[model samples]
Target chain A: MWLYFLKRLGLAVAVVAIVIAALFAMIHAIPGDPARVALGPRASEELVAAFRERIGLDQPILVQMGNFYVSLLRGDLGRDAVSGEPVLRILLSQLPDTLYLVLGSILVAVVPGVFLGTLAARHRGSLIDRVTSVISVSVMSIPAFVIAIYLLLIFSIELQWFPAIGAGEGVLDRLHRLVLPSLALGLAWIGYVARILRASILEEMNEPHVRTARAFGLSENRIMYDYVLRIAILPTITVLGIGVGHMLSGAVFAEIVFARPGIGKLVFDAIISRNYPVVTGAVLLTTIFFVLVNLLADLVIAWLDPRVRHDLAG
Target chain B: MTRNTALSIRDLSISYDTPEGRLRAIREVSFDVARGGITGLVGESGCGKSTLMSAILGLLDGAAIVESGEIWLGETDLLTLSRGEMRRLLGDRIGAVFQDPMRSLNPVLTIGRQMTDIQFRHRLSRRTKRERAIEMLHKVRIPDPAARLDRYPHELSGGMRQRVAIAMALMAEPDLLVADEPTTALDATLEMRTIELLRELQQEIGCAIVFITHHLGVVSELCDDTVIMYAGEVVEAGPTRALFEAPRHPYTDLLFACDPARIRERSRHLPTIPGTVPGLIDVPPGCVFAERCPERFAPCGRLHPRPLRVRGSEAVRCHLHDPEVTS
Candidate 1:
């Protein structure tokens, strides 16, 4: 199993390198002069040229990419376009906000999602099950932005349950301000997790081991929660990691719709302004984070479910 | 229900609600598993053996309806017990091992955990439960029982998993143990060894076992009593030797005839019962095997013959064995 994780780690490293390379090439593919795009049209020609030279745009594309890779390896994210500060420092400032939002949304999705899923599976084919199915499907059918708009309309605009815009202050302030955005971002994923967990629970309940459990006279609660749920929760765990990774990379809708100062918003602002250093650093960090998270999820699942190790090893 | 019997299944009828319609799966099946003995419930595929076992364990799905029945374990009617009541009776008074040992034990759980988990019905400490688990594993002849405890089900071979399953089932020292074709997925040697293990365990534990299988050889070789099922009905039931020797039901006789050992001359084709068992959806009011029976007489086609008591504790549900109908 350790060997399996070792191989996965190797694979994740390759994936990170590949993602960084692809994003670098994609940035280079942008049609306009990045220096002019950064300094804007009114800036002096000499300033644009100086900016291009500073970013190594005069160098060959391969050399430029090699430079980026080297600097990335050395933990240098280069300078911000306007502030002349390290891109890494700016991202470090933004990381906690994004982490809080993303992780908080995951909690929002999972706690209710797993609870509803368990309830649905326990009372499958009943009125409660039907209601849960309808709710989850309806939520899943709507896109994140639309859900965001609706939540803002109800909770922010009308009810004033939470402030609509900006990622807020410190720990409690950020958590308080995050409530709506987290809901908007995670509502659909809650449906996804619920559906996955419900199907898994239903499947687990009918398994031969479950029958054996029932025959041994395990209480229905113990059978459902302990025996069945332990196995059923595996698929949900994998899905959760993927969802969290996606959200971390850019909960673009949530970050933008709420005008939050999250990593996603920072990346979005950088991309729009052609802040090459910030964009590359933010994208690379996000890719590495996503890959590492997925690797961790796989290892956790393999630990919990030995049957998964065969597939993991392969 | 009788004092000598560990499980008494009386006039039990069960059905399943399918998309097509409600289909009768078990039709008034009756039998008694005597204490400290193995009773083999033999039948072909889809003949309600599994359904009956599920009913006995109260593990049937929502679609399954026990239309009428009484499963008596001791003086208490299991059918009358609530879910909680049945649960309390499970590991303490009854145990079960299913077919496909690959699926019978939870793949994620250690053998030790599963073994101890079943003993949750007991008021013993965790240490006592672990000790009992090791003891049961040893009884099933699993090598290095203590070390094997930490191994998960997937780590064990099919035979070893089945052994672990048996050991786990017997930890509570249940009064009755239901083996539902537990050896069906094993190789011939493993199957033989498992049957021997069951026999030795039954003798030692003094627990009645209702061994459900389709293997005639298994029944004849190991079971003290045999019940032959046709479709969803019990066609013949008695002491294994008596039933094998003077099997009165035409279905039982035909089943024995279909065995490969009975064929003296070498042939390219093997003997088979000519027709398939009828679907339970629209059962006819006649012998379940009448369509396939060569000796099916006048009354066989028109009337359903109840099991006729031909000898002491022996019965056959065939017109040939029904003297009034035959006469």
Candidate 2:
């Protein structure tokens, strides 16, 4: 098991490295002048050159990448080109909001999604199953932004239940603002989770163990929850890992719609302003977060299913 | 003979709604199992033996519909009970051992947890449940029951897991134990051990056991009475020894001839029944087995023969076995 974990960690490190390099190259490749954007369009060529030198962009791409890696190793992410503040500090401050959004969204998706999915599976061919199936399919078909806009219009504009365009007053207020956006993003996610869980549970229900449990005279509820759900939920762990990655991306649109000051909004601002440091920092942080979330999911899956760990260990 | 019947099925017919339409899986299958007797229901795959067992336990999923039947356990008709009532009766009064032990046991949970959950559901106290689980584990002959209690299903071997499942079923000392191909998945030695263990457990508990399997050898070894099913019908039933010695139904004879031991004893070319069991959707009008029966007569394809008692307690459904006919 230790060997397998080490092997997976090694693979994860390699993947993160590749992702970082690609992101760096892609950011550089975009047709824009970060120096001009930093110093303003009216600045002379000399002023732009000075700003480029100050931000270390005057160096060759390879040298800049080398310095980025070196500084990363030393826990420094350099200063933002526009604000001239430490990129690491900005990221550290914003990281919690993003974490809160991801965690909250996942909780919102998983609980109701699993319950509804199991219900659909148990009451298969019933009206409830059909309705849930249709709803899930419809929710999954629509993009996150569309759902976010629809939620914003209904919950914020018409219903007036939540604040329209900003994070609310206190911690509770922030959580309240987070509720609508999280639900918006998680609506589609819940659909995906429900569908996956429903399929898995249906498949599991047919397994010999399920029949055995039923034969044991276990209540339908007990059998469904204990035997059926336990086995069925294994694959959902993998889906959840991928879902975190998806949720992070979805949070970008959600952050824009809700005007929440999360990493997604920061990245969006960095992209619009062409702030290389901020963009790179935000992208790299999000990538790392995605990788970490996936790694955690892998570990969770291994914990739930010994077969996976045994296979990995072997 | 005075012993109470553990399970009594009368005119039990089960059907299911398929894409094609409603398809009957079992038709008018009736049998009674006396307390403490190991009654075996044997047939080829898709012959509704498993379906019959599922119907009896009220475990049939959404697709299956019990068309007409009275599954009586003691005085109560199990078929008439609500889901809540059935749930309460299950595990406490009737236990089931399934075919695949690995699938039957929860992979994520420990043996102790699985056993204790059943005990707890039956309202046995936690401490007593633990002790009873360990005791049951010991009874099933699992080595180092204490250490094994912590182990998950995957950690144990197939045979050991099967024993654990058996132990769980026996925990409540249910009045009726339904074993559906319990030994089919085990090796030769494990199979023998399981059969022996089951026999010992049955003797101790004195519960009526309904053993469902396709293997005649298993039935001969473990069952007191035998019911041979063919295409959703009971074609033959009698005491195990009597049925094995003189199988009246052509299907039963074919089943015995197909047995490895029986085939080995017959120096001539081994006999095999041609064709598969008919699909439930398009069952032929007359006898379901007429297409496959080698000794099928002209009337065999035109007349459906109901089960008729021949001699003693033996019953056969073939025209040849009819008392009015002389072969």
* Best model per DockQ: 1
DockQ of each: 0.82, 0.66
Candidate 2's residue-wise lDDT over B1-327, tens digit each? 134788888889999999997788999898889888999999888889878888777778778988897989998999989987887888889989988887878777788888887765646677788888888999999888989998888889999999999999888899999998999999989999999999999999988999999877888988999988888999988899888887788788778878877655546666677787778887788788999998988778878887788873467888886655534
Pairs that collide in candidate 2 are A209-B103
> lDDT per residue, candidate 1, A1-314, as tens digits?
67877878899889988888888789889888888888889999999889989878889888888988788789888899867899999999988878878887888899889988999998989999999998899888998888889889999899998989987777777788989888887888778888999999998887888889888888889888778888999999999889987677547668888998868998888888888888888988888788887888877888788778756656
DockQ of 1: 0.82
TM-score of 2: 0.93
Question: Which regions of candidate 1 fall more than 4 Å away from where they truly are?
Answer: A310-314
- Superposed Cα deviation of residue B102, candidate 1 (Å): 1.0
For candidate 2, the docking band is: medium
Could you tell me which 10 consecutive residues in candidate 1 chain A have the lowest summed lDDT?
Answer: A244-253
Question: lDDT at A89 for candidate 1?
Answer: 95
Q: How well does candidate 1 score on lDDT at residue A248? A: 76
